[model samples]
Target: MSGAIEFWFDFSSSYAYFAAKRIDALGARVGRPVLWRPFMLGTAFRETGARGLSTTPLKKDYARHDWARLARAGGFDFRLPEGHPLIALAATRAFYAIDEDSPAEAARFARAVFERYYIEGLDTTSARAMGDFAAGLGLDGDRIAAACESAAIKDKARVMSESAVARGVFGSPWFFVDDEPFWGHDRMAMMEDWIRTGGW
Candidate 1:
């Protein structure tokens, strides 16, 4: 069987948010399924000793401007929440829990969470917020929120992050088309080409 396009990303990453908006379509065009894998960016930052764009001095401002430009160019709504780069642990865990039963639903839930944070300018860092997002999608909000605290879900999330780092994923919106890796939202076009031509 053909390998799926693995989309490893942080739920709090704006670049990942932009990528999330288009990745499914990219997968469709290439005749591959998208495996939406949500991991903790803080774990990656800790391992790589890198700071978030919002925390970095000069890059923060530039990133904000870039995000605005990308949003305008892509024709999507985007606004930095009050507490930018909020912890996405709860949401990530909830995604894994839901994914255990339904991957498509989990992807749907992840998109909703991204929209709530980036487009609606709301908080999705808390379990309650995650539950609300899940409930909005006709899921069991309480079960999902409760799963955030489960040992199994926590371990699953931790392992996923560790696996991502081990696989050389140092940034958000990282993609792996088979064994080849692509980083950043801007690399999506290059990734598409690589997939189309079966790599150069």
Candidate 2:
């Protein structure tokens, strides 16, 4: 099989939400599988001393406008959740826990979580929210919520975030085509080109 496209993203990232909607199809078009890896963007911020797009000064306003434009162009509904830049630790942990058992379900759960926050304007930052979403998908929500608090899952999430930083990932929607790193949702076109041409 061809190498999977490593899609590193944060649940709280609006741009990452956009990438999630399109990435899987991109992978299908190229005969490559998409590996959705959710990591804590907070860890990256701590390491890089960077603020989130929603929290940054002038950029935050620009981002809001850009997000709307992107939504219109993509024909997807999008709205910032009540509290922008939510703490996604619970969601990330739950994702890894579920992923261990079923990758496809985990990906579906991830999309649902993103929709809950970005589309429905709901809070998805808590374990309860994660459970609710999981239950809606016919998974064992209670068990998933309990797993989020497990030391093993917590450690797994932390290690994944650290690994992302180690791999030079500093932003949501980061992608790796082989060893080359591409950051930001806007880079998806370039990523497609790279995949089609086998790099320049």
Q: What are the lDDT figures for the candidates, one per model? A: 0.91, 0.91
Query: Candidate 2, which segments miss by more than 4 Å at Cα?
Result: none
| Candidate 2 residue-wise lDDT, 1-200, digit = tens | 15989999999999999999999999999988988899998899999999998888999999999999999999999988777888989999999989999988888989888888898876667787788789888999999999998999999999999999999999998999887899999999999999999999
Q: What lDDT would candidate 1 get against the real structure?
A: 0.91
Task: Compute the lDDT of residue 167 as modeled in candidate 2.
Answer: 90
lDDT of 2 at 12: 93
Candidate 1 least-lDDT 10 residues: 119-128
What's model 2's TM-score?
0.97
> In model 2, what lDDT does residue 152 have?
97
